[model samples]
Target: MRRASSLIAYAIACCLGWPAQAQDYPAHPIRIIVPTQAGGVSDILSRTFANKVQNATGATVVVENRTGANGVLAADYVAKSTPDGYTVYLGFQGTQSVLPHVEPKLPYDPTRDFAPVVLLATGPAVLVVHPSMPARSVKELVELAKAKPGAYSYASAGFGTTHHLAAEMFKLAAGVDLTGVTYRGAAPANQDVIAGHVPIEFDNLGLAVNNIRSGAVRPLAITAKDRSPLLPDVPTMAEAGYPSVIAQSWFAFFVPAKTPRPAIDWLNRQANEVFSDPAMRDQFLRQGLVLPLGSPEFLGQHVAEETQRWGEVIRKAKITLPN
Candidate 1:
């Protein structure tokens, strides 16, 4: 009888301690994992957010880069990590939305293996062409491509990247035929375009800003709903007569599934606080990013919708990865 009474007391104590433990979460340093090589947009964004988190919480936040298999390595690492809120992921559209449709046998299920924490920011891509191409605007480019199908080629970061998909979308929307050239990364792809080897390409504005300003590459249209302040002269894709080609890359925060709800809520509150600051919003804007605020559930819904949208596009374009 005494042993039974002691067992009941212990169970009640555990139930009470959970909330207290969650309230005192982050008693130690936290790590944010970036699923790409250092110096890329993902790495830069992760580091910047980590700094803000550290400033707000006074906790040591470390940003770690684990690049391989197009962000699969770092994502899988975080997915299988302990659900203690100490380890988090800075997931992007490619890993969370595009990979599942392209890689038939992805090791980790993006939807099932991770829980959404917050949506960070989104950035649009710019349709840039080498100055030697002679087509100065989006309409002229489409007309030129229609006149000489397959004569012009476009470059992208890789076969199944957002850059590649955006170009494919443009081809379908404009009813033009242009060959696609794949590169190991965006830097090389952009370099080849700047060198005039590749006539055209779609790249993130942040990556192509300097080149655009330097007159190395000409910006025709931005794949966004509205024109960006950085390039006030560039028109939106919709205004360029290709409303269906709109695409924007997004970043968000995630933790391993089954993480305590209180911990997730705490993390979400911290993120909202950091991004709500005027300075942080301006910093992101200066980097060509637009911050969109939302709760965790909102992020999950957004991911689901994006995955469905991209899946349809991939199917129509017949995009797939080799085994």
Candidate 2:
């Protein structure tokens, strides 16, 4: 009986030592999983966060790209990971807000399966067309599309991505019929647009800014309430006469549900601090993104509101994806 008690105590102690306690959290290296290819916005931001966190706390931080199903694969992986703080997910509006409504049978619920950490940044998409295209302004593009319904196609990063939804919203609000050409990612979609394989795309401003400035693509209007400073000459959709076509992309951090409150709070504080720096803020603004620092509760509430907002867009646009 004494031996049995000793073995039991040993097992309990080993379990406790595995991750240490929430107070001594991050006893082990933490891994942040991103749902996009490396060199993309998501991957770049995730790596930046990891590097900053490691620098600030001297804790090992790893960023892994687990791409598939337009972020569902990585998100589901993080959802099923240990509830310990070791595994983190950098999820964007598509995975957290839009996918919930688009894919009813998603393996994990964004709200139910993960605990909110922080909302990192947000930005709008730039409405761009190939340089060869005659359209120079949003009005001209609408006129051209109206003249030839279904003759023009726009590149989408994926079926249910922000790129896709933004195009759909434009179609609905502008009363045009432009077919969508889906690509594996924004990089390839923008590449094809630049290559003239596709004439139109609503691309992330960060990704489209260089091409827009290089004259590889013509900037029509941005899908934002205010014109981006990076391309201040470009008008907003509202200013272009489509007040209902506002769409923006946002990114946030989350961990598997049931992670200790202390770990969540620690991560939230660290991320907010890293992004709130003036240098960091200016860096993101130069890239056409805005850093938003807020508590975990703010992220949670934002997710809920965005889900509902996108749900209406999905329903109205009648969007569906293939299995």
Top candidate by lDDT:
2
Clashes of 2: 0
Regions more than 4 Å wrong, model 2:
1-22
Please list all clashing residue pairs in model 2, or write none if there are none: none
What TM-score, over all chains together, does every model reach?
Answer: 0.92, 0.87
TM-score, structure 1 vs. true: 0.92
Largest TM-score belongs to which candidate? 1
Give the local distance difference test score of model 2.
0.89
> CA lDDT of 70 in candidate 2?
74
Worst 10 residues of 2 by lDDT: 14-23
Per-residue lDDT tens digits for candidate 1, residues 1-323, read 99999999999998899889987887888899998778876787678777987887787889998888888998999999999898999998889999999887788899999999999888889999998988989999988999988999999988767689899989888989999999988889998999999999999888888999999999999999999999999999999888888788899999999888888888788888878889988878877888886899999998998898788888988888844
